[model samples]
Target: MGDFRRSRLSSTPVVGRVVEWKKTHGWIEPECTIDHPEMAKHQGHIFVHGEDLVPKWRNLVAGAMVEFFLYYDGQGLGAEECTSRKVLRVTLPWKHAKEMFGESGEKLADFEQQTHVTIRAYQWCQPDGNNSDLPFLLFEIWGRPQAVVESIGALAARREQDGNAAEDTLCVNLLLPESRMWKVDLMQLQHYCSLEVSSSITITDPMPCRTLTIQAPLPHFRSSLHALIAQAACVGNLW
Candidate 1:
């Protein structure tokens, strides 16, 4: 009985290069420009704040390509919707982590050695159909509801495809980018999963899907296809 609607507000991901890096309340808050259609509507700038870095990440400079997650409840959303929400946490590139920690395959399971966080892959964080590269970062600022996330979350839970599931449980994968991968970074990600979670989420429960491609039924995400469709009135009744 996982509520896809409820989960939509939890947290979202983004990918981009650093536009600005600030020391906010002694923490690093970086603003990036995402190419999502919603971003295009906003003129393409989003703010992502991070409380603590893994010490090694302290040197992350501006212009560094990175991907991270943002949590925005949007109690007081305004025209500057991107930074309207609070940034609970942020993550850097996974390759950086792997490079720094050295092939931490089984080492990730032992919490005593963990000093970082991990977030899995999700549609919001991936690149759009039009873009050749993966989207840089993700943020959930208040606007209209995330029509696209809601649709995919609901549909994915209904069936299986690409060897993914066909159950009511929506099968959204969370750790593809490993940005603050709280799914596996147990000590740091305690807020995201069950208390008993200890290891990395390798395979996720999937829903039966009708297609399998780099970007299948859920396509043209960066353009915010569903959002565009909703805007155009093709699927007006869906909302």
Candidate 2:
């Protein structure tokens, strides 16, 4: 079972044009202040760091392109974490990998695989519920606790209200916005599978080009021993 209490730290920052700006409290909005000359006419949405969300960060102006960091920390690998299955363990050119996984191509190959997975990284937050739009770090994962992803999708598919898309890509979908329920459900699914899950991560991106890297207590992940097999099964019918 995956234990989110272990305190793992990771982060990723994306540069994009800010589309809106708002400052409810004393937060500085990045959407209003940060400027991205690279995209003077082109438009793109910045991936807001889930952890950092200060009142000041909200000062950003709409249409201002800025690079906001996404960091994950505080969570650690618990005793009940997901067990790893088979890992492809491929090595490719950094430039080519970056084309697909962004400048931080460290774990590029892991991201391309169409596997069910979820990444647990540190998120910045103030003492209160407030945080900045920038994250301190970032991490990528392709498959994990395969059982968790499979089970959750299955449960959601059973429900009439749940759509087929939700069932097909529950794990991938959750990556955009990691949630507590999904995290808890991942652990629960592990128990049901009776399999030991582990993680295997690699760093391939160069520092000079992309200075984004996470420092953590855990060793650099390679390939996992365990693999998510066909046991879990699909969640719902085909769309």
Worst lDDT 10-window in candidate 1: 77-86
Tens-place lDDT digits, model 2, residues 1-239 = 22233332223333233344344211112223234442232242323321233323334344332333422233211111111221111222333334544575445335433334332233345558786343233332223344333322322212222455333221111111111112233343343332222232222222111221111111111101121223221111100
How much is 108 displaced in model 1, in angstroms? Answer: 33
- lDDT, candidates in the order shown: 0.28, 0.27
* lDDT tens digits, residue span 1-239, model 1: 11123212214433333445565312112333333333432234444434323232243345343434533223211111121111111112345334333364344333212312222222222234452243222211111234334433322322345665432222222222222232233333223222232245432323211111112233322223233222221110110
Which candidate comes out best when scored by TM-score?
1
- Model 2 segments beyond 4 Å from truth? 1-38, 41-139, 142-187, 195-239
Count of residue pairs whose backbone atoms collide, per candidate: 33, 67
Worst 10 residues of 2 by lDDT: 216-225
